[model samples]
Target: MKLLIMSDSHGWADEVVQVVDRHKHEVDELIHCGDSELQVDSKELSGVKTVKGNCDFGADFPEEIKETYGSLTLYVTHGHHYNVKMTYVPLSYRAEEVGANLVCFGHSHVADCFMEQGVLFINPGSMRLPRKPKEQTYVICDITDTEVEVSFYERVSGEKLTDLSRTYSR
Candidate 1:
Protein backbone atom coordinates (compact mmCIF):
# COMPACT_ATOMS: atom_id res chain seq x y z
CA MET A 1 0.00 0.00 0.00
CA LYS A 2 1.05 3.63 -0.56
CA LEU A 3 0.24 6.46 1.85
CA LEU A 4 0.65 10.22 1.54
CA ILE A 5 1.19 11.86 4.93
CA MET A 6 1.24 15.58 5.76
CA SER A 7 0.87 17.76 8.82
CA ASP A 8 1.02 21.14 10.54
CA SER A 9 -0.38 23.12 7.67
CA HIS A 10 -1.47 25.77 10.16
CA GLY A 11 -4.17 27.21 7.87
CA TRP A 12 -2.57 26.82 4.46
CA ALA A 13 -5.61 25.18 2.94
CA ASP A 14 -4.74 25.75 -0.70
CA GLU A 15 -1.34 24.08 -0.36
CA VAL A 16 -2.95 21.08 1.30
CA VAL A 17 -5.39 20.76 -1.57
CA GLN A 18 -2.61 21.08 -4.09
CA VAL A 19 -0.48 18.40 -2.49
CA VAL A 20 -3.40 16.00 -2.20
CA ASP A 21 -4.43 16.62 -5.77
CA ARG A 22 -0.91 16.03 -6.99
CA HIS A 23 -0.70 12.53 -5.58
CA LYS A 24 -4.31 11.49 -5.22
CA HIS A 25 -4.18 8.92 -7.94
CA GLU A 26 -0.89 7.35 -6.90
CA VAL A 27 -1.56 6.87 -3.22
CA ASP A 28 -3.87 4.41 -1.54
CA GLU A 29 -4.50 6.62 1.50
CA LEU A 30 -3.99 10.22 2.66
CA ILE A 31 -3.36 11.33 6.24
CA HIS A 32 -3.05 14.69 7.92
CA CYS A 33 -1.43 14.80 11.32
CA GLY A 34 -3.31 17.96 12.23
CA ASP A 35 -2.87 21.64 13.11
CA SER A 36 -4.73 22.19 9.89
CA GLU A 37 -6.68 25.09 11.41
CA LEU A 38 -9.53 24.22 9.10
CA GLN A 39 -13.00 23.00 9.85
CA VAL A 40 -13.72 19.29 9.95
CA ASP A 41 -15.82 19.67 6.82
CA SER A 42 -13.25 21.73 4.92
CA LYS A 43 -13.04 20.78 1.28
CA GLU A 44 -9.24 20.71 1.40
CA LEU A 45 -9.37 17.86 3.87
CA SER A 46 -11.87 15.80 1.97
CA GLY A 47 -10.97 12.10 1.85
CA VAL A 48 -8.00 12.63 4.16
CA LYS A 49 -7.92 10.98 7.57
CA THR A 50 -6.99 13.64 10.15
CA VAL A 51 -6.60 14.10 13.90
CA LYS A 52 -6.84 17.09 16.20
CA GLY A 53 -3.74 19.11 17.02
CA ASN A 54 -3.05 21.37 19.98
CA CYS A 55 -3.90 24.40 17.88
CA ASP A 56 -7.18 22.92 16.69
CA PHE A 57 -10.04 24.54 18.60
CA GLY A 58 -13.12 22.36 18.25
CA ALA A 59 -14.10 18.86 19.30
CA ASP A 60 -15.13 17.76 15.84
CA PHE A 61 -11.77 16.29 15.01
CA PRO A 62 -10.56 13.19 16.82
CA GLU A 63 -7.42 13.25 18.95
CA GLU A 64 -6.13 10.10 17.39
CA ILE A 65 -6.99 7.41 14.88
CA LYS A 66 -6.11 3.80 14.12
CA GLU A 67 -6.51 2.30 10.68
CA THR A 68 -5.70 -1.03 9.13
CA TYR A 69 -4.56 -1.28 5.52
CA GLY A 70 -3.96 -4.75 4.24
CA SER A 71 -1.40 -6.18 6.70
CA LEU A 72 -0.33 -2.85 8.13
CA THR A 73 -1.83 -0.97 11.05
CA LEU A 74 -1.41 2.82 11.34
CA TYR A 75 -1.77 5.02 14.41
CA VAL A 76 -2.12 8.73 13.67
CA THR A 77 -2.01 11.67 16.08
CA HIS A 78 -1.02 15.34 16.28
CA GLY A 79 1.68 14.46 18.88
CA HIS A 80 1.21 17.34 21.33
CA HIS A 81 -0.75 15.17 23.77
CA TYR A 82 2.14 12.74 23.76
CA ASN A 83 4.80 15.44 24.18
CA VAL A 84 6.40 14.34 20.94
CA LYS A 85 8.53 17.49 20.72
CA MET A 86 10.62 16.00 23.54
CA THR A 87 10.48 12.26 22.91
CA TYR A 88 8.59 9.43 21.29
CA VAL A 89 8.30 7.28 24.42
CA PRO A 90 4.75 8.30 25.16
CA LEU A 91 3.70 7.98 21.55
CA SER A 92 5.41 4.61 21.33
CA TYR A 93 3.44 3.30 24.29
CA ARG A 94 0.22 4.50 22.73
CA ALA A 95 1.02 2.82 19.46
CA GLU A 96 1.71 -0.44 21.29
CA GLU A 97 -1.59 -0.09 23.06
CA VAL A 98 -3.38 0.35 19.76
CA GLY A 99 -1.49 -2.58 18.20
CA ALA A 100 -0.19 -0.37 15.40
CA ASN A 101 2.97 -1.10 13.45
CA LEU A 102 3.19 2.32 11.84
CA VAL A 103 2.95 5.55 13.83
CA CYS A 104 2.40 8.93 12.13
CA PHE A 105 2.74 12.21 13.98
CA GLY A 106 3.76 15.87 13.57
CA HIS A 107 4.58 18.47 16.22
CA SER A 108 8.14 19.71 15.96
CA HIS A 109 7.92 20.48 12.27
CA VAL A 110 10.97 18.36 11.65
CA ALA A 111 10.55 15.57 9.12
CA ASP A 112 11.99 12.23 10.06
CA CYS A 113 11.33 8.48 9.95
CA PHE A 114 12.80 5.65 11.94
CA MET A 115 12.21 2.18 13.34
CA GLU A 116 12.02 1.51 17.03
CA GLN A 117 10.82 -1.51 19.00
CA GLY A 118 9.66 -3.07 15.74
CA VAL A 119 7.50 -0.09 14.90
CA LEU A 120 7.96 2.63 12.30
CA PHE A 121 7.45 6.26 13.35
CA ILE A 122 7.18 9.11 10.89
CA ASN A 123 6.98 12.88 11.27
CA PRO A 124 6.07 14.69 8.05
CA GLY A 125 7.11 18.10 9.34
CA SER A 126 5.16 21.32 8.88
CA MET A 127 3.73 22.25 5.52
CA ARG A 128 3.59 25.95 6.31
CA LEU A 129 6.06 26.55 9.11
CA PRO A 130 9.06 24.32 8.82
CA ARG A 131 12.09 23.85 11.01
CA LYS A 132 15.39 21.92 10.97
CA PRO A 133 16.15 21.41 7.30
CA LYS A 134 13.90 24.40 6.73
CA GLU A 135 12.01 22.77 3.94
CA GLN A 136 8.22 22.70 3.93
CA THR A 137 7.74 19.00 3.51
CA TYR A 138 5.54 15.90 3.59
CA VAL A 139 6.05 12.18 3.16
CA ILE A 140 4.96 9.32 0.99
CA CYS A 141 5.35 5.77 2.24
CA ASP A 142 5.42 2.71 0.06
CA ILE A 143 4.89 -0.48 2.01
CA THR A 144 5.47 -4.12 1.18
CA ASP A 145 5.90 -7.34 3.11
CA THR A 146 9.64 -6.95 3.47
CA GLU A 147 10.28 -3.24 3.76
CA VAL A 148 8.88 0.28 3.76
CA GLU A 149 10.21 2.99 1.49
CA VAL A 150 9.68 6.53 2.74
CA SER A 151 10.16 9.49 0.41
CA PHE A 152 10.01 13.09 1.50
CA TYR A 153 8.79 15.81 -0.83
CA GLU A 154 8.66 19.58 -1.07
CA ARG A 155 5.11 20.59 -0.23
CA VAL A 156 4.65 23.37 -2.76
CA SER A 157 6.66 22.04 -5.66
CA GLY A 158 5.76 18.38 -5.25
CA GLU A 159 9.38 17.54 -5.89
CA LYS A 160 10.97 14.57 -4.17
CA LEU A 161 13.76 15.29 -1.71
CA THR A 162 15.78 12.24 -2.55
CA ASP A 163 18.33 12.86 0.17
CA LEU A 164 15.69 12.26 2.82
CA SER A 165 14.40 9.03 1.30
CA ARG A 166 14.85 5.87 3.34
CA THR A 167 13.98 2.21 3.21
CA TYR A 168 13.55 0.25 6.41
CA SER A 169 13.29 -3.51 6.78
CA ARG A 170 10.07 -4.83 8.24
Candidate 2:
Protein backbone atom coordinates (compact mmCIF):
# COMPACT_ATOMS: atom_id res chain seq x y z
CA MET A 1 0.00 0.00 0.00
CA LYS A 2 1.06 3.59 -0.61
CA LEU A 3 0.32 6.46 1.76
CA LEU A 4 0.53 10.20 1.22
CA ILE A 5 1.54 12.14 4.33
CA MET A 6 1.55 15.91 4.88
CA SER A 7 1.17 18.41 7.69
CA ASP A 8 1.07 22.01 8.95
CA SER A 9 -0.84 23.48 6.08
CA HIS A 10 -2.00 26.35 8.28
CA GLY A 11 -4.96 27.44 6.12
CA TRP A 12 -3.55 26.84 2.66
CA ALA A 13 -6.63 25.17 1.25
CA ASP A 14 -5.68 25.44 -2.39
CA GLU A 15 -2.37 23.62 -1.91
CA VAL A 16 -4.03 20.90 0.13
CA VAL A 17 -6.67 20.42 -2.54
CA GLN A 18 -4.03 20.31 -5.21
CA VAL A 19 -2.10 17.62 -3.40
CA VAL A 20 -5.21 15.49 -2.79
CA ASP A 21 -6.33 15.76 -6.37
CA ARG A 22 -2.83 15.03 -7.61
CA HIS A 23 -2.31 11.82 -5.67
CA LYS A 24 -5.78 10.58 -4.78
CA HIS A 25 -5.71 8.02 -7.54
CA GLU A 26 -2.28 6.63 -6.69
CA VAL A 27 -2.11 6.47 -2.91
CA ASP A 28 -4.06 4.09 -0.72
CA GLU A 29 -4.30 6.58 2.13
CA LEU A 30 -4.06 10.34 2.63
CA ILE A 31 -2.96 11.67 6.01
CA HIS A 32 -2.75 15.16 7.44
CA CYS A 33 -0.67 15.49 10.58
CA GLY A 34 -2.55 18.60 11.74
CA ASP A 35 -2.52 22.42 11.79
CA SER A 36 -4.58 22.34 8.62
CA GLU A 37 -6.93 24.91 10.14
CA LEU A 38 -9.80 23.67 8.04
CA GLN A 39 -13.25 22.81 9.21
CA VAL A 40 -14.28 19.17 9.58
CA ASP A 41 -16.90 19.58 6.85
CA SER A 42 -14.46 21.11 4.38
CA LYS A 43 -14.11 19.28 1.09
CA GLU A 44 -10.33 19.33 1.40
CA LEU A 45 -10.49 17.01 4.38
CA SER A 46 -13.16 14.66 3.02
CA GLY A 47 -11.09 11.48 2.81
CA VAL A 48 -8.09 12.46 4.91
CA LYS A 49 -6.91 10.89 8.14
CA THR A 50 -6.01 13.82 10.45
CA VAL A 51 -5.00 14.71 13.98
CA LYS A 52 -5.23 17.91 16.01
CA GLY A 53 -2.20 20.13 16.47
CA ASN A 54 -1.61 22.86 19.03
CA CYS A 55 -2.93 25.38 16.53
CA ASP A 56 -6.10 23.42 16.01
CA PHE A 57 -8.95 24.37 18.35
CA GLY A 58 -11.94 22.10 17.72
CA ALA A 59 -12.48 18.61 19.07
CA ASP A 60 -13.71 17.24 15.80
CA PHE A 61 -10.27 15.84 15.12
CA PRO A 62 -8.55 13.35 17.36
CA GLU A 63 -5.17 13.95 19.00
CA GLU A 64 -3.95 10.64 17.71
CA ILE A 65 -5.06 7.80 15.41
CA LYS A 66 -4.15 4.16 15.17
CA GLU A 67 -4.92 2.32 11.94
CA THR A 68 -4.09 -0.99 10.35
CA TYR A 69 -3.25 -1.41 6.69
CA GLY A 70 -2.61 -4.91 5.44
CA SER A 71 -0.22 -6.28 8.07
CA LEU A 72 1.20 -2.90 9.13
CA THR A 73 -0.04 -0.96 12.11
CA LEU A 74 0.31 2.83 11.88
CA TYR A 75 0.14 5.41 14.67
CA VAL A 76 -0.51 9.02 13.70
CA THR A 77 -0.12 12.12 15.85
CA HIS A 78 0.61 15.85 15.77
CA GLY A 79 3.60 15.49 18.19
CA HIS A 80 2.94 18.55 20.35
CA HIS A 81 1.66 16.55 23.31
CA TYR A 82 4.84 14.53 23.25
CA ASN A 83 7.05 17.65 22.84
CA VAL A 84 8.54 16.69 19.52
CA LYS A 85 10.57 19.93 19.35
CA MET A 86 12.72 18.70 22.21
CA THR A 87 13.01 15.00 21.50
CA TYR A 88 11.27 12.02 19.94
CA VAL A 89 11.89 9.76 22.96
CA PRO A 90 8.46 10.43 24.39
CA LEU A 91 6.76 9.76 21.08
CA SER A 92 8.87 6.70 20.53
CA TYR A 93 7.79 5.34 23.89
CA ARG A 94 4.16 5.90 22.94
CA ALA A 95 4.66 3.98 19.71
CA GLU A 96 6.07 1.07 21.65
CA GLU A 97 3.04 1.04 23.88
CA VAL A 98 0.77 0.93 20.85
CA GLY A 99 2.78 -1.81 19.13
CA ALA A 100 3.06 0.38 16.09
CA ASN A 101 5.39 -0.55 13.26
CA LEU A 102 4.97 2.87 11.67
CA VAL A 103 4.53 6.26 13.35
CA CYS A 104 3.64 9.41 11.47
CA PHE A 105 3.92 12.79 13.17
CA GLY A 106 4.40 16.50 12.48
CA HIS A 107 4.76 19.64 14.64
CA SER A 108 8.39 20.56 14.30
CA HIS A 109 7.90 21.37 10.62
CA VAL A 110 11.05 19.42 9.85
CA ALA A 111 10.94 16.55 7.40
CA ASP A 112 12.62 13.46 8.72
CA CYS A 113 12.43 9.65 8.70
CA PHE A 114 14.19 7.07 10.77
CA MET A 115 13.91 3.63 12.30
CA GLU A 116 14.32 2.81 15.95
CA GLN A 117 13.95 -0.58 17.62
CA GLY A 118 11.86 -1.88 14.69
CA VAL A 119 9.52 1.12 14.47
CA LEU A 120 9.64 3.73 11.74
CA PHE A 121 8.89 7.42 12.42
CA ILE A 122 8.27 10.01 9.77
CA ASN A 123 7.59 13.75 9.72
CA PRO A 124 6.56 15.16 6.33
CA GLY A 125 7.29 18.80 7.26
CA SER A 126 5.09 21.85 6.78
CA MET A 127 3.55 22.53 3.39
CA ARG A 128 2.96 26.18 4.23
CA LEU A 129 5.66 27.39 6.58
CA PRO A 130 8.43 24.86 6.48
CA ARG A 131 11.52 25.25 8.61
CA LYS A 132 14.97 23.63 8.48
CA PRO A 133 15.41 22.56 4.88
CA LYS A 134 12.42 24.71 4.02
CA GLU A 135 11.22 22.94 0.91
CA GLN A 136 7.49 22.68 1.52
CA THR A 137 7.59 18.90 1.68
CA TYR A 138 5.39 15.82 1.99
CA VAL A 139 5.98 12.07 1.92
CA ILE A 140 4.92 9.14 -0.18
CA CYS A 141 5.44 5.86 1.62
CA ASP A 142 5.21 2.58 -0.23
CA ILE A 143 4.82 -0.39 2.08
CA THR A 144 4.60 -4.15 1.78
CA ASP A 145 4.94 -7.07 4.17
CA THR A 146 8.73 -6.96 4.18
CA GLU A 147 9.79 -3.41 3.44
CA VAL A 148 8.95 0.25 3.11
CA GLU A 149 10.21 2.85 0.66
CA VAL A 150 9.76 6.54 1.42
CA SER A 151 9.94 9.27 -1.19
CA PHE A 152 9.82 12.97 -0.41
CA TYR A 153 8.19 15.48 -2.71
CA GLU A 154 7.67 19.21 -3.08
CA ARG A 155 4.06 20.27 -2.54
CA VAL A 156 3.93 23.06 -5.12
CA SER A 157 5.87 21.65 -8.05
CA GLY A 158 5.18 17.97 -7.33
CA GLU A 159 8.89 17.28 -7.75
CA LYS A 160 10.51 14.34 -5.97
CA LEU A 161 13.58 14.83 -3.81
CA THR A 162 15.48 11.72 -4.78
CA ASP A 163 18.31 12.44 -2.38
CA LEU A 164 15.96 12.22 0.57
CA SER A 165 14.36 8.97 -0.58
CA ARG A 166 15.04 5.90 1.45
CA THR A 167 14.09 2.22 1.74
CA TYR A 168 14.07 0.13 4.89
CA SER A 169 13.70 -3.64 5.12
CA ARG A 170 11.64 -5.33 7.71
Candidate 3:
Protein backbone atom coordinates (compact mmCIF):
# COMPACT_ATOMS: atom_id res chain seq x y z
CA MET A 1 0.00 0.00 0.00
CA LYS A 2 1.17 3.52 -0.73
CA LEU A 3 0.15 6.13 1.81
CA LEU A 4 0.62 9.86 1.51
CA ILE A 5 1.07 11.46 4.91
CA MET A 6 0.59 15.14 5.60
CA SER A 7 0.31 17.37 8.62
CA ASP A 8 -0.06 20.90 10.00
CA SER A 9 -1.39 22.64 6.97
CA HIS A 10 -2.77 25.46 9.15
CA GLY A 11 -5.24 26.35 6.40
CA TRP A 12 -3.16 26.39 3.25
CA ALA A 13 -5.85 24.57 1.35
CA ASP A 14 -4.37 25.35 -2.03
CA GLU A 15 -0.95 24.03 -1.11
CA VAL A 16 -2.36 20.91 0.49
CA VAL A 17 -4.72 20.37 -2.40
CA GLN A 18 -1.97 20.75 -4.90
CA VAL A 19 0.16 18.19 -3.11
CA VAL A 20 -2.63 15.65 -2.98
CA ASP A 21 -3.62 16.21 -6.56
CA ARG A 22 -0.03 15.76 -7.60
CA HIS A 23 0.32 12.35 -5.96
CA LYS A 24 -3.16 10.88 -5.91
CA HIS A 25 -2.35 8.51 -8.71
CA GLU A 26 0.46 6.77 -6.85
CA VAL A 27 -0.94 6.62 -3.31
CA ASP A 28 -3.73 4.38 -2.09
CA GLU A 29 -4.67 6.36 0.97
CA LEU A 30 -4.13 9.84 2.37
CA ILE A 31 -3.66 10.53 6.07
CA HIS A 32 -3.55 13.93 7.68
CA CYS A 33 -1.96 14.11 11.10
CA GLY A 34 -3.56 17.45 12.03
CA ASP A 35 -3.51 21.26 12.42
CA SER A 36 -5.51 21.67 9.23
CA GLU A 37 -7.11 24.81 10.74
CA LEU A 38 -9.93 24.43 8.25
CA GLN A 39 -13.47 23.39 8.83
CA VAL A 40 -14.19 19.68 8.97
CA ASP A 41 -16.29 20.12 5.84
CA SER A 42 -13.54 21.80 3.93
CA LYS A 43 -13.35 20.69 0.32
CA GLU A 44 -9.59 20.19 0.38
CA LEU A 45 -9.91 17.29 2.81
CA SER A 46 -13.00 15.70 1.30
CA GLY A 47 -11.71 12.15 0.89
CA VAL A 48 -8.85 11.85 3.30
CA LYS A 49 -8.30 10.44 6.81
CA THR A 50 -7.80 13.28 9.30
CA VAL A 51 -7.37 13.80 13.05
CA LYS A 52 -7.58 16.81 15.31
CA GLY A 53 -4.77 19.14 16.30
CA ASN A 54 -4.35 21.43 19.29
CA CYS A 55 -5.31 24.28 16.99
CA ASP A 56 -8.30 22.55 15.35
CA PHE A 57 -10.82 24.34 17.54
CA GLY A 58 -14.50 23.34 17.47
CA ALA A 59 -14.01 20.77 14.74
CA ASP A 60 -15.38 17.32 15.40
CA PHE A 61 -12.00 15.63 15.23
CA PRO A 62 -10.83 12.78 17.36
CA GLU A 63 -7.75 12.94 19.53
CA GLU A 64 -6.50 9.71 18.02
CA ILE A 65 -7.48 7.32 15.28
CA LYS A 66 -6.70 3.78 14.27
CA GLU A 67 -7.23 2.33 10.82
CA THR A 68 -6.16 -0.81 9.09
CA TYR A 69 -5.14 -0.94 5.47
CA GLY A 70 -4.59 -4.54 4.54
CA SER A 71 -2.38 -6.02 7.30
CA LEU A 72 -0.89 -2.75 8.54
CA THR A 73 -2.35 -1.09 11.57
CA LEU A 74 -1.92 2.68 11.65
CA TYR A 75 -2.12 4.90 14.69
CA VAL A 76 -2.51 8.63 14.17
CA THR A 77 -2.67 11.67 16.43
CA HIS A 78 -1.73 15.32 16.73
CA GLY A 79 0.73 14.59 19.62
CA HIS A 80 -0.06 17.61 21.74
CA HIS A 81 -1.30 15.37 24.56
CA TYR A 82 1.98 13.49 24.57
CA ASN A 83 4.20 16.60 24.58
CA VAL A 84 5.59 15.55 21.20
CA LYS A 85 7.54 18.80 20.87
CA MET A 86 9.87 17.41 23.55
CA THR A 87 10.10 13.62 23.36
CA TYR A 88 8.69 10.59 21.56
CA VAL A 89 9.50 7.90 24.12
CA PRO A 90 6.03 8.10 25.60
CA LEU A 91 4.48 8.24 22.16
CA SER A 92 6.44 5.22 21.04
CA TYR A 93 5.24 3.27 24.04
CA ARG A 94 1.66 4.18 23.26
CA ALA A 95 2.04 3.01 19.67
CA GLU A 96 3.11 -0.37 20.97
CA GLU A 97 0.12 -0.53 23.26
CA VAL A 98 -2.13 -0.15 20.26
CA GLY A 99 -0.16 -2.61 18.17
CA ALA A 100 0.55 0.01 15.60
CA ASN A 101 2.89 -0.84 12.77
CA LEU A 102 2.90 2.82 11.73
CA VAL A 103 2.47 5.65 14.19
CA CYS A 104 1.76 9.00 12.56
CA PHE A 105 1.68 12.32 14.34
CA GLY A 106 2.25 16.07 14.14
CA HIS A 107 2.41 19.23 16.31
CA SER A 108 6.05 20.29 16.17
CA HIS A 109 6.19 21.39 12.54
CA VAL A 110 9.27 19.20 12.15
CA ALA A 111 9.51 16.26 9.76
CA ASP A 112 10.88 12.91 10.85
CA CYS A 113 10.64 9.20 10.02
CA PHE A 114 12.29 6.12 11.49
CA MET A 115 11.76 2.48 12.29
CA GLU A 116 12.09 0.92 15.72
CA GLN A 117 10.82 -2.32 17.26
CA GLY A 118 9.54 -3.31 13.82
CA VAL A 119 7.22 -0.32 13.68
CA LEU A 120 7.46 2.88 11.68
CA PHE A 121 7.12 6.26 13.35
CA ILE A 122 6.44 9.05 10.90
CA ASN A 123 5.90 12.76 11.28
CA PRO A 124 5.19 14.59 8.05
CA GLY A 125 5.85 17.97 9.62
CA SER A 126 3.91 21.02 8.50
CA MET A 127 3.11 21.49 4.86
CA ARG A 128 3.07 25.17 5.71
CA LEU A 129 4.72 27.16 8.47
CA PRO A 130 7.52 24.71 8.97
CA ARG A 131 10.04 25.51 11.68
CA LYS A 132 12.86 23.00 11.28
CA PRO A 133 14.92 21.58 8.44
CA LYS A 134 12.82 23.07 5.64
CA GLU A 135 10.06 25.51 4.86
CA GLN A 136 7.53 22.74 4.08
CA THR A 137 7.83 18.96 4.10
CA TYR A 138 5.84 15.72 4.18
CA VAL A 139 6.35 11.97 3.76
CA ILE A 140 5.17 9.26 1.41
CA CYS A 141 5.13 5.78 2.95
CA ASP A 142 5.28 3.07 0.35
CA ILE A 143 4.76 -0.34 1.86
CA THR A 144 4.59 -4.00 0.97
CA ASP A 145 4.51 -7.29 2.86
CA THR A 146 8.28 -7.48 2.93
CA GLU A 147 9.39 -3.87 2.90
CA VAL A 148 8.46 -0.26 3.53
CA GLU A 149 10.00 2.63 1.63
CA VAL A 150 9.46 6.08 3.10
CA SER A 151 10.58 9.30 1.47
CA PHE A 152 10.15 12.91 2.54
CA TYR A 153 9.03 15.53 0.03
CA GLU A 154 9.49 19.26 -0.09
CA ARG A 155 6.33 21.24 -0.75
CA VAL A 156 8.19 23.23 -3.40
CA SER A 157 8.95 21.36 -6.61
CA GLY A 158 8.09 18.04 -4.91
CA GLU A 159 11.71 17.17 -4.31
CA LYS A 160 12.76 14.23 -2.16
CA LEU A 161 14.63 15.20 0.99
CA THR A 162 15.66 11.70 2.17
CA ASP A 163 14.83 8.10 1.53
CA LEU A 164 14.39 5.73 4.50
CA SER A 165 13.57 2.20 3.49
CA ARG A 166 13.54 -1.08 5.44
CA THR A 167 13.03 -4.75 4.68
CA TYR A 168 11.57 -7.22 7.12
CA SER A 169 12.99 -10.62 7.98
CA ARG A 170 10.85 -13.65 8.44
- TM-score of the candidate numbered 2? 0.97
Taking all chains together, each candidate's TM-score versus the true structure is 0.97, 0.97, 0.92
What is the overall TM-score of model 1 with all chains considered together? 0.97
Top lDDT: which candidate number? 1
RMSD of 2: 0.9
Q: Give per-residue CA lDDT, model 2, range 1-170, as digits (tens).
A: 99999999998898999998999999999999999998877888989998998888874899899997767999999999999999999999999999899999999999999999999999998999989567999999999878999998999899998877799997
Candidate 1 per-residue lDDT, tens place, 1-170, comes to 99999999998888999999999999999999999999999999999999999888983899999988777999999999999989899999999999999999998899999899999999998999999669999999999999999999998788899988899998
Candidate 1: lDDT of 11? 89
Worst 10 residues of 3 by lDDT: 161-170
lDDT of 3 by residue, 1-170 (tens): 88899999997899889999989999999889999988889999988789999999998878899987778999999999888999998898899899898899999998877778878888888898888775588888888887777788888789887543333431
Between prediction 2 and prediction 3, the one with superior TM-score is: 2
Q: Which pairs of residues have clashing backbones in candidate 2?
A: none
